[model samples]
Target: MARQLDEQIAGRFQVGQRLRVLDVGMGQGTQALRLARAGHTVTGVEQDTTMIAAARRDLAAEPEGIRDRVRIILSDGRDTGVHFLPGSFDVVLCHGVLMYVADPDPLLAGLARMLAPGGLLSLLVRNGDALAMRPGLSGDWAGALAAFDSNSYRNRLGLDARADRLDTLTATLAAIAAPLHAWYGVRVFTDLAPDGAEPPADLDALLAAEDRAGRTDPYRGVAALLHLCGVRD
Candidate 1:
């Protein structure tokens, strides 16, 4: 996801430009901190208190310059309008967040409004179209059969979550005037890997294969996660 975002940013923005970034549902601030270190001013909004504390601790460990570029905000992503003016950021990220939102349209619209013209809106969502893949591959016939009929499922964390189909999202983005720009599959082959599993000895090769499959279709369509970018025109 990070690699894909970086590539998109590099392609769209000029080098040395100090972009204003807003990371909604930033969790532990992994992407937020990485962008801050690269000289982008980043604001991370997280609703979880424990996550906020962890992110702050991580920020504090960074050098002064990097630390100064990051701000942590305690707020729900849906309230972004209350906290920030429209068109305030060059990049707005709402990764791994929409599934938890029962009604994601309003939140997605708010995120789109946060982007400046030509700004990027990056999203990482579970692939509803491929929801049956995991169960089918695991030989869970009943689960696979059920998955084909619904987008809601219990995630690894045992939380009830929803998934998004690419086609549906494309139409939504168009309606918000942030049309789909680019997209890639994520964790195409590694979705079934055990939680917290150590990287294989040939980690680099694994990533290489994943990257290739992510951009190559038929394969990409069945990936577990979809990394989508929209441009606010």
Candidate 2:
């Protein structure tokens, strides 16, 4: 996911452009710190106190130069308006967050509002259209059947979450004046891999195959996650 986002950013902006970045639901500040290290000014907003503390700890460990580029805030993603002015950021990231939101439209609109014209909105979401693939591949007949009828499922963390269909999100983005620009499937072949599973001996080769499938046709359609990039108009 990080690699993909880096590619997108590189494609849209020049190196050392010093973009303003807002990472919503930035757990542990992984992406936030990475962008800051790359010369972007990043602000990480996280509601979880433990996650905020962990992110701060990680930030503190960085050299002063890198650490100075990042700021961590404690707030829900929906409250972006409270913390920032409209069009404050050049890049808005809401990765791995929408599934927990019961009503994602309002939150998405708020995020869009934070983007300057032509700013990028990067979203990582669970794929509703492919929800049945996991259960069916795992031999869970009942779960697979249930998935075919609904977008809600129990995630690996045992939390009830909802997935999003690409079409629905595309339309929503258009309505918000941030049309979808590009999208790629994530974890196309490794969605069923067991937790903590180590990479195979040919890790590079495996990743190459996964990367190809993520951008290909039928395979991408059934991927576990979707990485959607929208551009604010």
Candidate 3:
């Protein structure tokens, strides 16, 4: 996951270029800190005050030089005002956030609006289509079928939380005139492991194999989620 993140961030940056980066739903500012350290100016938009405070404290704890390159704003992405100009950023990152939203179209539109011409948008969405692939692959046919047919894997706030698929997300991006490049499966193997259970050597190899499988056709359909990137036209 970290390797994939580094690659995605690197795509939007050139060394020594004073670029602007926006990390919407910037939980803890992990990506923001990375871009800032690479010499890009970063603006993180997050609505949760507690999360904002923690991010602020984290920036304070960083070495003085890195902290100065980043700024955090307490605002939702949809409403960040003239504080940020359109076409101001080189990259816009939205990760693991669409899952909580009932309708992602608005957020998608908002990100598209913020993206500069030829600028990149990197998105990580929960792979709804893979919800049942694991249990099915693990030989639990009943549980697998249930997850496959259900709208949600688990109930949230007495409601179902729908998962997303690469096709649906790609369509959303296309609506914004942003075409996607090759996408890869993220967390394809590690997520299904028993928590805190270290894998044996053979199992490690198997996990790596599955990760590769999750990147290919047929197998990719069952991955935990997908990551995609491209630029607005």
Candidate 4:
């Protein structure tokens, strides 16, 4: 996903351009710090105090140069309008957040508004259309059957969550004037991997295979997660 984002940034902007990045729900400030290291000015918005503490601890370890590139805000994604103006960012990231929101469309629209012309809006979401794939392959026929008609499910954390279909999201982005630029499947063949499990010795090869399938046809459609990027008009 990092490589994909860098590709978009490189293709959309000139060399060494310092970008203004807004990272919504930036857990532990991982992506925010990474972007700052890459020379972008990043502002991370997170509502969780624990997460903010963790991010701050991590930030404290970096040199002053890197620390100066980041700003941590104690607010959720919905507060963007109150914190910044329209077209305030060259990139807006909303990853692993839509599932938790009861009303995601308006939230998405707000995120799109923060992007400048031709700026990137990156989203990571559960694939609603492929919700049945996991249970089906696991031989849970009843669960699979139930999932076929529903876009809501309980995540591993035991929280009720919603998912978005690609078609629906595509139309929404179009209406928002930030049409889909490129999308890729994530966790296609790796969804079943156990949490905190060690990587296999063939980690690179496995990732290569996953990356190839993510960009290819049919296989990508059944992936567990979808990575969608939209460009502001």
Best by TM-score: 1
lDDT of 3 by residue, 64-165 (tens): 788988989887777744577677877888887777788888878778778788887888777888888767777988878888676465532355566787
lDDT tens per residue, model 2, 38-95:
8889999999999999999999999999999998888889999999999999999998
lDDT at residue 96 of model 4 (Cα atoms): 91
The sequence of per-residue lDDT tens digits that candidate 4 reaches over residues 1-233 is: 77667878898989999999999999899899999999999999999999999999999999999999999999878979999999999999998999999888898999999999999999999999999988888898998999999999888878999999999999999999899999999888999888899999999999898988988999999999999999999
Candidate 2: lDDT of 20? 99
| All candidates: CA RMSD (Å) | 0.7, 1.1, 3.5, 1.0
Best prediction by lDDT: 1
Q: Where is the poorest 10-residue window by lDDT in model 2? A: 1-10
Clashes (candidate 1) = 0
Model 1, span 127-230: residue lDDT tens: 99999999999999999999999999999999999999999999999999899999999999999999999989999999999999998998999999999999
Q: Better model by TM-score, 1 or 3?
A: 1
Q: What clash pairs does model 1 have?
A: none
What lDDT does the true structure give each of the candidates?
0.96, 0.94, 0.76, 0.93
Per-prediction tally of clashes: 0, 0, 0, 0
